[model samples]
Target: MAFNRTRWAALAATVVLAACGGGGGDIVPSPRVPFTSLVSFGDSLSDVGTYKVGTVAAAGGGKFTVNSASARIWTELLASDIKVPASCPAQTGLLPNVPGFTGAPVTNTPACTNYAQGSARVSNVFAPSSATLQAAPFNQVNIGLTAVPVTQQIAAHLAKTGGSFNGSELVTVMAGGNDTFMNINGVSAAAGGGAAAAGAAVAAGWPTATQQAVAAGGAAAVNAAATAAVTAMGQAGAELAGLVKTQILAKGAKYVVVVNLPDVSQTPFALAADAQTRALVNQMVTTFNSQLAAGLAGTATTVVQVDVYARGRDQTANPSRYGLSNVTTPACSTTSPANPLQGSSLACTTASTIPGDTSGFLYADSVHPTPLGHQLQNQFVKEQLAAAGWY
Candidate 1:
């Protein structure tokens, strides 16, 4: 799935042509596109709660941000601004292996259209908290995320909509964070020399050879694993862009807003990693973003690209400018016994935050954004959409 330089260069050219409107067709202006529905697809960042049942629901936990009736992720906030009905999860379920949490069978809500789920990757079926990866030797504490990749999320939407969009829906996509995470985990396992752990990481679609290479321990093997993981990340980005063009746009979606991956290396999650690992994670994020931008450049008219990476970096560099008081510390309490998913923003509430005013904090957990952080993202997306004349 790796893309060579020539292919990317050609794709970049397509972006230029498309941005210019393919030979500058007649300058015809029309009324703003009427968006009656806000359709969304991606991971936890945009998730409106695909796992808001059982213990998670009882704990008032669902979306990645602080869980409360009033808490709104960026997508939900955007839906409000667009004058559409409040978005709800297209599906809901939780099949965790842990006790005390009652597992809910997967249920579909045809009326809702937000397809984003926590832990979803771009195209990979296996992801963090997924049943397959949480089983046996890995035995990750089950949070019960379905982790249905964005590719299938789009398919589910198409199937429910009679195989095509109505062209009036405002679609937003934000994924690949989990893909980058899986790659990082793969690299760690391969380098740590744990065969079982490496095998489990391979379930996320890193080549099985990575596990074998780990067994035959050496710096060269570890480097090979890192290279393969990064290459796969770029491929995942390209795959997402291809899905957007072929599955979404080709199926009649007129307004597609694709939010690129943010720099996860800047998140609190990376603070625990060594310098080398953090650098590797940064490389993976940039690589994914680059491939995604190149792949979607050709459809500039219909696709709006939101540069979240740049925004995140800016927020990190100058937190005060963004009204953020703390960019490095997570607002949520990662050490709460009452919280079933300790350290996860999913279980975080106003009562569970670190002491003092957390309203200005940028993160809710190691990886998810706080409400204010989501607001910034919401504002950023609206700005992008307005600039593209698609809002």
Candidate 2:
């Protein structure tokens, strides 16, 4: 979600179209069946197509709090497999499940909260006794939604007045990427000192690997963030499991799966930006996953680790292999730097220092992925969701 700029002193945080993908390939696959329902929550990654949207508009053209553009996320694609209720889309469809609720499951249940806003953090933005996206049309048939860090999401669910909200009964995650972004190195310039120097560096080809290595240094910082998140998740997960034991498993909900994050290093940002940076980021990802695995040790909740990064790289390495010769996004060049945050070296824009496509898989505007790029991610997500029983 955030990236570092080599020219600048400090790497400014910017949300990329990281709409990255990782369909649970090889490492583990899904059972290829729908859950009780399909649902999602998180930052841009799991925004379920609510990104840049105002609100879910009757499953057709509409707008919301975000920009007026109507964009449906991968979740909409799930209709091919999951069953969606007709009266429950584009708005809150949740009715109070029991006594505590006054026919209102949540305080702020909108038809579709998306739950995942751009650059959103893993915190509860819900109100007690309020309905969430569960009853909405966008994802009503697919599954339920929950943001990551797991703890906060559970807190909101547990606090609800109505019953039927238990962590153990469902998948316990919203996917992870911000964790990886936080681990990247930083660049600063005494507030405003490096602009000129940054320009000079650009004229020199800007040493992509070196800048990336610096980002790699951010691993420690990210580790600290992950540690805190993991600690909080463990405590929350245990409580959720207890609730599941009482409600779902004890009652009837089957299989509690906790998805593990993919290798963040393989994201388009890491790849286009710098090789050294990608390596460092990958290492940090490995470290964090190990820590997360340790936290999830010996639990009945199955941990599904999606290998998106490696799979993404494979797509990049031989894009043509996937029928992406003309459709794939381009990567890296002076005209279009690896990332917008990593703006072109001064000379690059002028067609002087850097020029034509340096990396074949990058986009002309290096930051966002091409349609081909989005497709690859779709493939990965489809693969993993099926393997992990997401249907």
RMSD of each: 8.5, 13.7
**Where does candidate 1 have its weakest 10-residue lDDT segment?**
13-22
C-alpha displacement of 71 in model 1, angstroms?
1.0
What stretches of model 2 exceed 4 Å from their correct place?
1-34, 49-72, 85-108, 111-114, 122-151, 161-172, 185-268, 271-275, 297-303, 326-375, 385-390
lDDT of 2: 0.35
TM-scores for the candidates: 0.89, 0.50
Worst 10 residues of 2 by lDDT: 59-68
Q: List, residue by residue over 1-391, the lDDT tens digit for candidate 1.
A: 1112222221110100000000111122322667889999988888888877887777777778777768888888778877789999999988887777666999999999999888788888777767655666666666567878888999999998899999989999888888776676666655456664466457647667666776564576568777877898899889989999999999999999998887877877776566777788889888988999989987989999988888788788888887878888877776676456765777778867888998988888777888788788877877777778765
Model 2 agreement with the true structure over 210-282: per-residue lDDT tens digits: 3333334345433333333344333333433343354334434454433344444444345555565556555
